[model samples]
Target: MNTPPGLHLKIAEWMPENGEVVSAYDIAENFGITIRQSRAFLTILEKDNAIETRRGKVMPITCHNSHRRSTRTIKVISIDRDIIAQRRHHYNTYRHCPLKSINGLSRAEKWEFIIRNARRRKK
Candidate 1:
């Protein structure tokens, strides 16, 4: 059988800027992997010190500037400490808003937000 899907690239892509934090669901959808797959990948990455996840408030460095003005603070996984540090510097300069957890939001809800907001800008 073929080798299993490698999540290294996905993990790299999922890493947020210095001050951002992403949820497990975010990584799954972003990498087009299953939720379980994302979790498994994250477990491995955490061990490798490729990414960091923590309880409570992970800030978002980037945001959607649409009318809805919805923001997300996602946890990030980065290979280079400098990159994350630079992003943190940028955040200091730009002042990105810190992300807050929304109670009662399921994985599906988060996906809907991404899709809906993405579509809204296409028009």
Candidate 2:
């Protein structure tokens, strides 16, 4: 597939070795490309099915097919906490429910609460 010069190199640097989804905006800013150019490049990737786009900050990209095994790669930056806080401030007006109750609910209850609430937000 035709790609811009240094695209793969930048991809390698930005993506984890195990390969995880990344944000197009973040990639664009890191590569010094305009948002328009980044969108076009991302379209090219999507046409090839090189990446799976979703309406979120993170989009999953195709990693090497040779490595069929799935690997979980945590993000380098842990800004989700701040982001969630900001989101809460902006959108969440009601009392926040604790993932785990003060009584310390079972693991299933905690997981269920988080999963249910996370799905309440948009992508």
TM-score for candidate 2, residues paired by index? 0.31
Residues 1-123, model 2: lDDT tens digits: 344764733453455542555555556667777655665655544443333333334334465542333322222221134543465467655766665453576889877777876855577
lDDT of each: 0.55, 0.49
Cα-based TM-score, every candidate: 0.37, 0.31
Clashing pairs in model 1, backbone N/Cα/C closer than 3 A: 15-77, 16-76, 20-74, 21-74, 21-75, 22-74, 22-75
Across 45-64, the per-residue lDDT of candidate 1 in tens digits comes to 65545355443354343445
Leading candidate by lDDT: 1
Regions of candidate 2 where Cα sits further than 4 Å from its true position? 1-9, 17-20, 49-123
